[model samples]
Every structure is written in structure tokens, then in C-alpha cells.
Target: MKSSNVFYLVYTLSLLLGLLCVIFVITWSKGYRGGFAWDGSAKMFNWHPVCMVTGLVVIYGNAILVYRLPFTWSSSKLILKLVHATLNLGALSLAVIGLLAAFGFHNKMHIPNLYSMHSWVGFIAVILFGLQWLLGFLCFLLPCTPLWLRAAYRDVHVFFGLCILAMTVASCLSGINEKLIFVLNAPNSTASYKKLPPEAYLANILGVLLLCFSLTIAWMLLKREWQRPNLHASALSDATEPLLTED
Candidate 1:
């Protein structure tokens, strides 16, 4: 198979596999009233480790595609377009699957705090990413369109892309720290419930901090874009008689 197909297939399959892993992890965590211990609770379940490792791998693998997209083939239009589409669609799928895991699908399963935050934030980030992808696709697909509209679309796309990237980082860190899992079960933790380690608390704070940073960066980019002019601005300026007049 061609490189593109390989990339697409691996990326797509990773997404599906990651979805399954997420589902299984959520299901496994339901047994723990407080925070589930990897050694005591998760090790007993075959799916937990599989889900955690595979889901994580899938997320990282997808990031590889994201990284490759802009820099790898700066001169190749066709390849760039294909990679971009794959990342956008694949990210969307992961986001949806994550949401299902968090929302307690079928009412039989629910991931605790860490997983829940991971899911919700992931979904929001994906929503922002989808908007970014939609606007980008429109800008590229509609080259004959008005310059002003194209510029506006591109600006929106750039700003949202940055947002998605930030959210992606937060989601990944939350997943790694396993704090999101702890947060979900926080309300139920008591004398009868198992207490989480100090590490989880730190992770939760980090998650919040990461989210704040992401939002702050996104706002900064949006402000910058709003103040900047599009390529058409130069074109419009060039068309005026003042610049064209032969001194």
C-alpha cells in the first residue's frame, strides 16, 4: 500500500482501538467507589491495562500525524491535504468515543473523575477542532470565493486550531496523571471510601492550570487575528488610484 494509505489505516485503526480501550477502562473503573488502584483493582481486569496503554498509544500516534501535517510536506499539496483531513476526522472520532465513555453509556458504566474530565474537555476541544477543520476546508475548497470571506475563515481556523492543540495537551496530561479519574469519584470519597494519594490532587490542579493556559493562548491568538489584515488588504490597497498614480 501507498504511504498515505498506511498512514490513514494506522491512524484510523488506532482511533477505533483507542475507543474500545476508553470504553473498557470506564467500565472497569465503575467497581471502585473511590479511586481505583492500578495494582489492586485494575490489574485484576484484563481490559484495564489494555485500555489504558492502547488508548494512550493511540492518542500519541494521532499526535504524530498532527505533527507531520504542517512541516513534513511543506511543498506537497496533495499529501498535506490528505493528512489534514485524516487528523481532523480522526480527532473528531476520538472525541465522540471519549464523550460516550464519560457520560455513562447504557447506564452500566461510568469512569470516575479523571476520566470524566478527560472526556468532557476532550469533547470540547474536538468541537473547537471541528470548527477549525470546517473553516479550513471551506477556505481551501472555495478559492474562487471573495477574498474577505476567505481571510476571515482562515483567521478563525488558525485561532481554533490553536485552541484544539491546547485542549489536546490538557486532555493528554489529565489522562496521564489519572487525576481526572480521581475527580469523578471525589464527591463519594469519605471515611468509608478509599482516599486518593497526594499525587492525584496535584494532577487535578495541573489539569486546571493547563486548561487555563489553553484558553488564555487561544484568546491571545484570536485577538491577534482580529487585529490583523488578510492578504486581500494589500490587494485592495494596490487597486486604489493613490498608489497607482505615476508621480
Candidate 2:
């Protein structure tokens, strides 16, 4: 298949995956009274998953693709860089809120934090994301930085961006499984995950959607046709211009 066709196909699927994630979260929230709150209840804890998926997974994925859009081909590189940074900042803000909600709920209940691999990996991914965003802003957005430095860091930025996305997705799946296990084993809950309840199916669907979203974003980033063209005269002037431009 043509690269354009594959790109659009994956893009459409990624959108569908995002929609499914929202629906699954809303359905679960409604079923369990898991609405957002600052009261440190289960509802407040619900905000963690919802925000993480929406911000870290969905919005972040789209932010990485902004430069790949055909309509942006003629747009100023500076504008695109700003848009990219702005979107990432938005994602980081949402993710921070999500983490706060989780920690607040746990602390209120006297639950231990960062005891699980999921939490450890998720935290690492968030930290790395923050550092990536900071470096990108300093090296690429700031006029004080030499063009050579920005060019040199472009590949590293892209590489780590994709790595962070993958890590987030994997951590999300692990978290879903962990939550399900806890809920199923709780004394008040009558249904067992062994029985494959509706919630179980919803969790499974959400995980699949997360995976699809990540895969689609990765494919789009890796596809040669979807990459942004280097139109800057300065970029072309470099004898050793990096093969990959910033997203």
C-alpha cells in the first residue's frame, strides 16, 4: 500500500481509538460514580486514568503529528515549533493534574505510592517528557541557541519523543490490569475478573485502543512521506544537515 494511504488509515484508526478510550472511561465512570472531584474519593482517583489517557496518550500523540499534516507544509517553521511546544505543555499540565489526583487519593487512603512497576515506569516517562520538552524549547525555540545545536539535537528529540510515548502506553496497560485486579479482589465487589465482567471487557478495550493509538503515531512518525519537508535555506546550507527535522 502507498505510504499516504497507510498514513491516513492509521490516522483514522488512531482517532477511532481515541474515541473509544473516551467512551470507555465515561462508561466506567458512570457505572462506578467515578466523576472528578478533589475530595480524595474513588471518583477523584478516576481523574488520573482519564487525564493520563487524554493528555499523555491522545493529545500528546496528536501534538507529535502536527508538523506531519499536509496543510502545515507552508506554515512558518517557528509557528510550527511553537504549536508543538504549546501542545506538549498542555499535555504536561493535564498529566501533572492527573498525577496529583492519584497521589492525593492514595495519601488520603494511606496507600503506598510508587510501589508498583507501573507507577515507577509512568513516573519515569513523565520525568523524561518534561526534560524533552524543556530541552526542545531551549535548543530549538530560543534564538540564543546556535542553529548547529538545534540541528544536532533534532534526532535525539524525535527518538525520545517516540520512546516516551511507547513507555506511557505500556504503563497505561499495566495500570489498567492492576486496577482491575484490585477491584476484583476487593471484599465489597461480588464480580471476579475471572468471570470476565463488562468492566473487564472495557478495560481490555481501553488497553487495545491505547496500543493502537501508540502504534499509529509511531507509524506516522516513521513514514518517510509523512515527514515535514525542510524548506529553510539555512537548513539546506548545512553540509551535515541532520536527516530528520523536528516534528
Candidate 3:
């Protein structure tokens, strides 16, 4: 099958899975005893945990698959280009689910301290991810011609990839606590909230740490590039060397 077709198929399946999971969770929250809490008051569905685990695996796995596509020449081979495209689309779908589930649990658990910050970060991450996905899809349709145009797309693609990587790292750091406690429907409370252990402090700490690291990395890379008078030809020859020699 064509990459596009495969992409649609996989994306559709993942979407359906997410929708079903959401429906199940919503129903459980509404009808089950105490609602989305870890006090053993609510009845958790058997499939919820399984589905979530599967989804996480798919999400991160797809990320690796997408970023290493053959179209890049350096990492991907022509024969596997279709697979790469499908995986890229699949990865985007998984990212959306990851964002949704992260927020949904946060709200359900009523993690007071992390609520607002998580909302904003999740929103921003989703927006950036959407842009990245669109640009990637466009690259699929656009012909690899007109040297300058192709170069522009390549640059844009790389920018989005870096953005995705950074945002994901940030989001993951922000959800570490939730992953450990809420993921298994484990039982505890934070501040005024009741049920589910209060681990926002840990997640927040991790988030800050990751933010500092990301900013520092960006600063160092930018500083090095800016120090160079001209980033042309021989100046970047070594940088382009690996890309040029890759088969």
C-alpha cells in the first residue's frame, strides 16, 4: 500500500482507540462510585490501563520512527520512505492522545498546583505539534525540486522536529508524577484536592530543570553559530559533510 494510505489506516485506528478510551473513562467517571479518584471508590475499567499502556508505547515508538525517515537521505532509505511517512502521521496522532490523556488525568485528579501550568504547556505543545504535522504532510506532496525551495522546506522541517523534541521532553517532565501514581489508578491528595498522591511538586521541579537545560542548549548552539562571521560554504562544510556522505 502507498504510504499515504497506510498512514490514513493507522491514524484512523489510533483515533478510534483514543475515542473509545475517552468514552469509557467518561462513563466510568460519571456512573462509577466516587468518580475518577484513587480512593478505591470508583470502578476502573479493565481495559483502561491496558489501552493507555499500549498508547504510550505507540506514541514514543512512532516518534523515533518518524524522525528517522529515509527522505532525509542521512537516516532513511528509499525503500522505507513509505513506512517513515506512515509512522510520522501515526506519531502525530499519538502525540495528540498523549497530550489529551495527560490533561484529562490532571483535571480528574484535581492536581491544584499543576493544573494551570499543565493546561498552558499542553495547549502550547499541541499547537506547535499541529504546525509540525502540517509542515511534514506538506513536504510529502511538494516535489523535491527547485533547490532553494527544497532547502526552505528542509529547514522548516528541521525546526519543527527540534520543537517537537523539546516540547515532548518538557511535557514528559511535567507528567512524571502523574505517570507514576495516576497511571496505575494508584491511591493520595495534594493541597485541597482529595485522592491521588500529590506529586505535582516533583513534576514541576522536573519541568523547571528541563526548561533550563533546553534553554541552555539553545543558547550554546545559537552562540556558536552567531560567532561565525559567515555560515556559508567552507564554514559549514564539516557540518554538511555527514549529510552529504550518507547513502
* CA lDDT scores, all candidates in order: 0.46, 0.83, 0.43
Candidate 2 — what's its lDDT? 0.83
RMSD of 3: 12.8
TM-scores vs. true structure, each candidate: 0.44, 0.90, 0.43
Better of 1 and 2 by lDDT: 2
The weakest ten consecutive residues by lDDT in model 1 span 238-247
Which pairs clash in the backbone of model 1? 113-180, 113-181, 113-183, 113-184, 114-180, 114-181, 115-180, 115-181
C-alpha lDDT of candidate 1 relative to the true structure: 0.46
Error of 3 at 41 (Å): 11
By TM-score, is 1 or 2 better?
2
State which candidate, 1 or 3, has the greater TM-score: 1
Identify the leading candidate in terms of lDDT.
Answer: 2
* Candidate 2, position 216, lDDT: 82
lDDT of 2 by residue, 110-180 (tens): 99999999999999999999999999888876666776787788779988999999998998999999999
